[model samples]
Target: MLLAALVATTALTACGLPRSGPNRNELLAGVEQTAGAPFAIPVDDNVARITAYEPPLTFPAAFRNAGVLGPDTINAGDTLGLTIYENVNEGLLAGQGQNFAVLDTVQVDGAGFIFVPYAGRIRAAGNTPEALRQIITAQLETQTPEPQVQVRRLAGDGATVAIMGDVGGQGVYPIERPTRTLAAMLARAGGISNEPETALVTVIRGNTEGTAWLNDLYTDPSLDIALRDGDRIVVKQDDRTYIALGATGGQSRIPFGKPVVSALDAIAQAGGLNTNLADPRGVFIMRNESPEIANALLGRNDLVGAQRIVYIIDLTQPNGMFFAREFLIRDGDTVYVTQAPYVQWQKTLSAITGPVGTAGSVNNALN
Candidate 1:
């Protein structure tokens, strides 16, 4: 009889007994006591109504001149078409490849400067093709009268940014003039593979990293940012995922995918809590460090302090519905539902027997 009882207890624990540790019920009650009971009146004036505030527009400096700038300057190993018009002879001298003698089609050196027959060594790094032409023309004027120089970049240098993660194509792409925007880069990579709107695009430029909403950049004209060389774009699809612990329904991961998720949405995703064991008043949402939303949640207080405390929400009363809707859930948010006190005994019994259930019938037979 003792062995049978022990085995039954273990099996119950493994299957999630109501009394094991801080099950759904006891945790919820403790939460209510800690975070104050929800307002009793259906429309309590004391309860603060969550107001919807428009998020301020954040613009990145990169996208200012999207189409304004022409193609970038040519680099070494890149093929080019050069034409030199000698005013004295009134004849057009053109070269197809780098061996063109009239225009001196020599490769750009490691120092980022190119050497022409009569132009000597001139700096071409960071200068556009047009800019380089003007420099060469000015230099030629010192030797040839009214000289005209034209430089066309046929191939691009290896300088490119890599787009990875949930994008359609994951590889390095050459930086084109019109393709400097984040959206443009994403399009070149064959667009987003999944969750185009919910995709998280991270720009990793050297050591500086910034994350922006891909949908916002597409819809909101103000948020478009210009991409730079060596930028890493990562798109991720992570919706339909929620964290559940303590006193919640199903005690399993819930999948939800929407433009925005609220505290209520999270609760609903977690099966709306185990009413039998949950403490309605003790609901909390834990969010990772995000400077953008920190100011609105904790006011102007020290962000470091506000970041440490989990945002507590009392759902015992009905008025919490409005507040829950106003509270926006960000990525990687953790929702914890507390349980009641009586469920603790059930947890103790389950803990003692949970392992036995996993060991199988052979172990029970041996015992």
Candidate 2:
């Protein structure tokens, strides 16, 4: 009898156990309440600014600017101006011409290196016109006594950076001048597709990527970075899309370029959630895995990856205001407001009554 009583007690405890934490769907719906809450903006506004420097200025020690030009960025079928400095024992004179004597005009081959009369193959691929001229001038002094050599890049056949993504015109922009800034290239590409205030512009240099907030660039004077050969500039439109399924009026995509939108702002944008049907206690916010989450998951077990998971924010709590403010929404973010169970029942009843109402109308017409 004692064994039977013990078994019965254990079964009752198991049956009475509290429900496990809410599932993914519930968590996602909860986030809708806190979707637009604002957080304290970072104090370091300079984080998004790009500091510009003039030529001959000390390059950032962290960046590699060895002044050694990279490989064959020059090619044939390109027009070049060759100037020969004739040291006539009287004085040094510089002469510029397109078709100079064999010794004067250096022809560039399919490979970017130029074949000067005396200076065999000097790599001119990534060097600026001025830099190339200096290199050739230095080389000529070795072969000829006081050999005066001048070099000019009349055609651009190498070292080009391709600009695409959210720009009016997408094409390969030649790295003509050595000191081309990101802003200049963007202008050449017909500017950004969206408003500069809301766009997110990034410069992909080799393997490293740098992000800049377009709005900051417009207001802050320091954020424009210089562009290098082979650099890629990508401009992305701000996506602030949210769904108001539960107690909000009119769900739709919010136009871009609004100020930092907080949960309160989002709710207001959604016509101040339908207070009549919304359960304030159940509001929530959801965000996809951030870079930090991805890094943490990679360090942990493989199966429990952070990249595939989403972050849920519960706004029903009083302290949720802090979280809502800090949570930022990025492009392609989706906000969904779940309908309450009672709301669903009401919808179902309305659908059921529609046919009965239609039948009644027909009978009245017949009478």
Candidate 3:
């Protein structure tokens, strides 16, 4: 009798407390009494009215202000084709009629200068082809009377941005068109090697640099802005992930397969909740929202200090699934499904039966 009573008490204690001490219910109950309760809001029809945390979908101002794609200015490493015409009778290079017309192909050097017979080394960088022609003509007037000059760009020195990293083709692509955009260039370089959701597109323009998810860039037209000269574009795999814990089918840090992962998809990716052990009414997604957004959503300044939010979803009702589909899951989010209250009791009952069965076996052995 004493052994049976002791086993029963132990079983009841096991039902009351979890292995790690407190269960989700106890933690939430304590939170309610001490603090004004975490921002526990149910995912429902009213949820649509509130602004929830979501991935950034808009392009940065630095990208939008990157200017439209247009013709590239003369830069170093460009090959130039020059034709100079001068009067035959009194010209420097004009020994005779038509012979005065001379064609010279010169390449601009590192100092942004091109060489002409009479003009010596003239600044060519930062000037248009027409602008460079005028400069040559002005310099020739001193040596020859009424000199006419025409400048043509034979070939560019491949003045293009390097599209490296996770791309189909990692090479230097020439910026041939003025209206060349980042998206257009990526297509030329064989698009991204990884899927849009798993790629991170980083842009380095001069000293300023920024990055955006490839999925966001693909969906938002505004993010497909123009690319500047010498811009470095790199596509890398996304490493940030979120954890799925508690009674979910898979408890691990799952990588976001895409830029914007919806709550329903996140749950599915986690292998769904453990049907037998999961509590349908205790589904939760824990994350921290900025104080500003939290305040705006709750419409109260007093709770502005609260950044940690436990968004609850009760899957017992059909409408709950609808809300789950709309809920957006951010990177670093934690999806936790509590164990069913009855599951705990079942475990305790099993523990009690094991001891009773052992005691009965010992009594039979002694008899």
Candidate 4:
């Protein structure tokens, strides 16, 4: 009878047990598809395969591997200067006293073609000034004897790139010989005004857009793509952040203190774990990973959409500290530390023995 009473009393003490979060065992046991359970992975050295791709600060293929290109291609809206020299015996474009006719400030129409007096309407865009010069000479030779022609391209709105945000200068700059590439154009604009580590460089080219870390423009050779006419570049300051929860010393949305933050760094930034309440063996980082990166991490291709993943870092295991230091903490990740297993037992014991001791003290006083 006493054993039954003790069991019932102990079970009652455990009812509705308060917890900061699920312990290691409960977290592992709670995986159910119907309940929308997240996949729990143990952090280790094996995760290094996809480490660099976690935050995915890289330019797309469209902005890679392009060699240095010359900026001489004519486009619509460019201004041109033309000079025509005709034979003195019979000058068609030039008057009898003048041997040459100068036509300046000629604008290429919206259809990428320019109209010359004797050459008629000819396509100018997609052709260099020298190429257009030869076409004009060929057209004038039919009517004028020994027609000599020269075409010069002037600085105009057609060959320019607009740079803005976090740069030393925010304006549209012409793409001349020195400012043909992205690196050169950035220098022409006075470079990035923010910290290189946390800055982002995004390029918008027509319908395509790509972005990378500002440092990558110099570090990675492939990322310094050639600038095209009408390209728009923007440099943005870092705004990525993460959240800390559970038994950590502090719980809040914490900014990534640096450009790159490891798991150890994030834990320290969150004021370290709560020694009295935290279970070091059950530290977790919860995140929603993209399908592409999730596939690479999980070694499967069937998964789609943002995957809910909870990564555990057991500090008590061998080399666990090393793994934690190596693992990177991405933006929006939740750092959680479950409560120690013995904490519940201590609470239950205090709850069951407290009233009994009070009643005994009262009985002794009355006797």
Q: Identify the candidate with maximal lDDT.
A: 4
Q: 2 or 3, which is superior by TM-score?
A: 3
In candidate 4, where is summed lDDT lowest over 10 consecutive residues?
A: 48-57
How would you encode candidate 3's per-residue C-alpha lDDT over 99-185 as one tens digit per residue? 465555688888889988888889998788889989999998988878888888887653678889999999887777733888888
How accurate locally is residue 278 in candidate 1, as Cα lDDT from 0 to 100? 79
Clashing pairs in 3: 69-178, 69-179, 70-178
Ranking by lDDT: 4, 3, 1, 2
lDDT of 2 by residue, 161-241 (tens): 688788999988875554256666788888888767768777777787666666665554445555565777788876656
Which 10 successive residues of model 2 have the least lDDT summed?
45-54
* Per-residue C-alpha lDDT of model 1 across residues 336-364, encoded as one tens digit per residue: 77676545545666577466577777687
TM-score of 1: 0.64
Q: Which stretches of candidate 1 lie over 4 Å from their true place?
A: 1-68, 72-78, 87-105, 109-111, 238-242, 253-259, 274-316, 329-367
Better structure of 2 and 3 per lDDT: 3
Each prediction's TM-score against the native? 0.64, 0.54, 0.82, 0.78
lDDT of 3 at 292: 73
**Candidate 4 similarity to native, TM-score:** 0.78
Prediction 3 TM-score vs. true: 0.82
lDDT of candidates 1 onward, in order: 0.63, 0.54, 0.76, 0.84
